[model samples]
Every structure is written in structure tokens, then in C-alpha cells.
Target: MKDWDYGELFEAINESYEEFLANGRGEKFAVARAFNEYANMGKIEDIITGVAIGEILASHDKVFIGYIEGITGWLSEVGKKDLKNELSDGEIENLLGRIATVIRDLRNKPIDSNPVA
Candidate 1:
């Protein structure tokens, strides 16, 4: 297994987040479509390639809703009202965490030493 570059991962996450904001309702859909295209060509990291599919497979809105509830609680406790949205920032953030975890976990999986390209 190779060491993962945390900085690079963070940068990717930032880029993805910007994409989400730009696309709004189609955010995850867009990421999933792009990720799948790359994964099919073996051009993306495995964990990232799997995220959207994971949510789709889980098939439960509540799981995602819980994420929002948790975030709302934190914001309320701190008196930061703006971060607490009805849609659940915590849930979306949880998805982000899942994305991060998958990438980190992929770093431990056996992979071809050569770049996919």
C-alpha cells in the first residue's frame, strides 16, 4: 500500500464541494456520473469511485437525515444558527466523511503499482 496524500485529498474534496454548490440538486448525481466514468476506465481512486454508489445502495433517506440532525444539534449548542439548515448539513457532511474514509481505506488496498493512464 502506498501512503495517501492528505493534502491532495483535501483539495479534491474542496473541488467536489464547489461542484455540489454549483449544481445544487444534481450534486451527488453529477459526482456519481463522473466518478463512474472514471472508475470504469480505472482512472480514479477506488474509494472515491464508490461513494455515490454506496449511498444509492443504502437506499435509506433517514440515514442521511440523521447526519443533518447531528449537525443541527452542534450548531444550536454553539449558537451558530446559520449552519443549521432544515436540509441537514450534518448529513451532507457525513457523506463527505464517507467519501474521505473510502479514499483512505483504498490507500490500504492492493492496487496496481503503475498509474492507470
Candidate 2:
């Protein structure tokens, strides 16, 4: 086994995303015919929770929740409430971009100094 590589990981995740769109649901209904199975188990939550924040973060959810509350307060200051509802596909793009940037920065920095702030 060699050292881990994130470029490969990113490619794998993108492939999963492509698969998500291929056989995706478009059900028939009198009132609605829309994309289904796109919001449930194939969600980005598990990826974010497990990798971006690390599994150890689950034990620090309270601390992270408080941090998120602080972020919500900042959003409110910018006239945005219910941020989750406001977020669109753009949010996913932003998260992916940030992940790539953070990974790049981390690779360039020394481990003992904690590049992940």
C-alpha cells in the first residue's frame, strides 16, 4: 500500500455522483412527477460527517453544533435565516471546492502545526 491520495478519492466520489443521476427516479403522479430518491440515503451528509469532519467529530457534535449556531448568527447578520432552505445546488459546489482547497493546503503544511484549523 502507498500513501493515500485525495485526487483519486475525489474522482471516485464524482463517479458516485454521476451514478446518482443516471438511474435516478422520475415517478409518475397526477399532481407531481419529480426527481425522487435524490434526497434520502444517497445524501452528502454521511460523506461530510465521516470524512470532512472525521468520525471523531461525532463525539463533539455539541461543540460543532455551537459552532454552527455561531455561523447561523453570522448568516442572520447578513439577512439570511433558515440557511438550509436557502441553500441550493451551489452549496454542494461550495463544499466540494472548500474540501479540495483544504486538502491542498493541508498537504503543503507541516503536520505538527495543525494545518486544518
Candidate 3:
């Protein structure tokens, strides 16, 4: 993909994130509008940032999806149990800690993946 695509994705992610933060942290219409705006912008750098942010967010989303699937699978195998007997407080804390570490690592990864500037 083009470098500018990353910028646009990043900007869209940021705009969505901003709306989430401002609007009680749930999906909303404004976030979607922001995404549309970012997609329509033609500047390469803008799009590149959007792509960078989107990549990071997408990675995190994937990780979370995996985690959820794993947890659900485990619970189902164990007779569809809920948190009441599944995870201890320590285990929950550890899982959250690992997620936080992942987020930090993703944030630190270089945005420029292209060979040419």
C-alpha cells in the first residue's frame, strides 16, 4: 500500500478514537463521519498517518478477538462457565497487563514500513 494510505488510516482511527472518548466511549455516528472525511482527503501524508493508526488499532483488535475466542472456547469446553469460576482476579489482572504490554509494543513499532520515502 502507499505511504499516504497509512496516514489516512491513522487519521481515521484517531478521529474515531476521539469521538469515542468524547461520546462516552462507545461507537457513534460522529466517529463514522470522521472516518468518511479522512477517507475523502487526498493528501498522502494524511492518509499515511491514518494507515499507521489503523494498522495499530487493527492489530490490537485482532489480538483482542483472539483472546476472546480463546476464552470463550475454553469456557465452552468447560461447560460454558462464566467468570464466576473461570478466571481469578490475579489471572484477569495478568491478562490485562499482557494486553497493555501489547498496546505499548504496537505503539512503539515504526510507522514507516515502505522502503522508499
Candidate 4:
């Protein structure tokens, strides 16, 4: 499996989010396309893609909530069997919620930039 670049992953998501905001909601969500691209890259890529999606959900507006079912359906269409199974079991939302919780908690914590000498 190729080593996925986190920068690229986040960049794709950010660009997609910007597009979603610029265009009306009627515009197809580019983030799902990004997820589709990454999900096919490898077995583990879906997990990373899920994390990216969760991060977006964590920091961004609630607009994405309305698209969860669509995203879940898209993933079911293209994701691996294990992912499909998880989606079928209706656990993707739970997983995303957990990931978002972790992201939200991390974001809430302050970073200490200065190191003790």
C-alpha cells in the first residue's frame, strides 16, 4: 500500500469544503469524491478518509450533517467489504462521532509551544 500523504488528504478535503461553500448546496459535494478516491487507494485508506471526514465534521458547520446518509451510501458503493459491512451495520455514524469527539477534544486543548530548557 502506498503511504498516504496527510497534507494531500487534508488539502483535498479543504478544497472540497471551499467548493461546497462557494457553490450552492445543490452542487455535488466534492468531499465525497475525495473520499471515493482515497477509499479505493488501499485497505487502510478508508480509515484515513473516515478520519478526514470526521475532522471536517468536527471543525466545520452542521451543513455536513445533512449529507451523512449520502456519504454513507457512496462509501457503501465503493468501499471495501469490511467498510461496507460496517456501513450496513449502521456503525459508521458511531465511528465518525467518536472520531469527531476525539478531534473536538484535541482542538479544545491548548498547545504549549515553549519547551522547558
For TM-score, the strongest prediction is 4
lDDT of 3 by residue, 1-117 (tens): 333333344555676667655776433333334445555444333323333333334344223333234323332232112222334556435434434444454444444332121
- The whole-model C-alpha lDDT of candidate 1 against the native structure comes to 0.39
Q: Across residues 1-117, which tens digit of lDDT does each residue of candidate 4 receive?
A: 256453465567667666665665532354555455556666545555666664554443343433454344433344344445434244445444545554554345444232221
Q: Count clashes in each candidate, considering only residues at least 3 apart in sequence or on different chains.
A: 3, 0, 21, 0
Q: Model 2 misses residue 16 by how many Å? A: 29
Please identify model 2 stretches exceeding 4 Å from their true place: 1-43, 50-87, 113-117
Clashes of 2: 0
TM-score of each: 0.28, 0.27, 0.29, 0.42
Candidate 3: lDDT of 28? Answer: 31
What is the C-alpha lDDT profile of model 1 across 1-117, one tens digit per residue? 033232343355446544654776554454444444434422123333345433332332223333233323322233224223421455446545665543344333443333221
* Residue 77 displacement (Å), model 4: 21
User: lDDT per prediction?
Assistant: 0.39, 0.32, 0.40, 0.49
**Error at 83, model 4, angstroms:** 16
Q: What are the RMSD figures for all models against the true structure?
A: 16.0, 18.8, 17.9, 13.2
Give the runs in model 1 whose Cα sits over 4 Å from its true position: 1-7, 37-44, 51-117
Better of 2 and 4 by TM-score: 4
RMSD of 4: 13.2
